[model samples]
Target: MGRTALIVIDMLNTYEHEDAQVLVRSVREALPGVKTLLERARAADAPVIYVNDNFGRWRSHHGEILEAALAGPRADLVEPIAPDEESLFVVKARHSAFYETPLAYLLGRLGAERVVLCGQVTEQCVLYSALDAHIRHLDVVVALDAVAHIDADLADAALLMMERNMAAELRPNGDITFGDARSD
Candidate 1:
């Protein structure tokens, strides 16, 4: 059993895009599960990493991003899952959290061998991050109910690909536990 960390990807979203409504709906459905996972992870003393998109704003910081997101149409989604003071925050320019980001180095520094992924765009960011983690030889576990997708069918395909090709575990939020009591 290795050290574990929880990666919350791209949840601090503005949700002002064309498909924002669709994405928000799915995120809303997953919010409860995500929240529960967060609480459990904290209780287990696992590190919480928040990998967020910069939204093409190279000069933007985390506070700015949070402010913009909370003031946007889907504040409901971003507000409830706001990162706490102890959480690690990383900004990424691409879909994959490791692409052009310090996520891999950060995870290594934290001594995290197993990563549990949770957040938005299941078929996009979450999927790409999972692939990147797999290539890094890190054990991956994706919280099935904690991820949101714009397209249900595409998300399902992505989940299957992750499970088959990357040997990633796809489990629901209730089944995930960290530290000594972790089942992964």
Candidate 2:
């Protein structure tokens, strides 16, 4: 467990597109893998950062976001749940969490030489964060089934985009065991 962090990007119950129901539906498939990764990071004392979008606004708070999401139209479909106090949450106003955010400095302080990104639509938030990691020269690995999009093509393109264009590699859950050393 070298200097690494697990970045769970935009998994908030908000911005639950693809018909809010699709959020849990899509995440249901990936949650286990993401959870496993999180657990390992916790045991290894690695950082776990939850990067979320400000959803088109600058002055946004996590509490406000959750309240609006619950009172919003998709309340039934979108379930806004809060994380335990131990986790770190980063609110961003753009696609990339690193854009005008303290993510870079936080990771630097954590001595994170690598970032494992997962969450939301692979076509959007996930892609941006991964590229930012690449630009910072941080190692990146994404789980294949752990990400998705309403438009299959967009998701496929996003995944392929990273693998071909940004040098991101896919780490399947089946091949990885929690607490196992990350050889890459």
Each model's backbone clash number: 0, 0
Output the number of the lDDT-best candidate.
1
Per-model TM values vs. the true structure? 0.96, 0.80
**Candidate 2, residue 49: lDDT:** 86
Model 2: clashing residue pairs? Answer: none
Score candidate 1 by lDDT.
0.90
Task: List the global CA lDDT of all models.
Answer: 0.90, 0.71
Which residue pairs in candidate 1 collide? none
Per-residue lDDT tens digits for candidate 2, residues 30-57, read 7666666666667767677888776776
lDDT (0-100) at residue 17 of candidate 1? 87
Report each candidate's C-alpha RMSD, comma-separated, in the order given: 1.3, 3.3
Model 1: lDDT of residue 127: 97
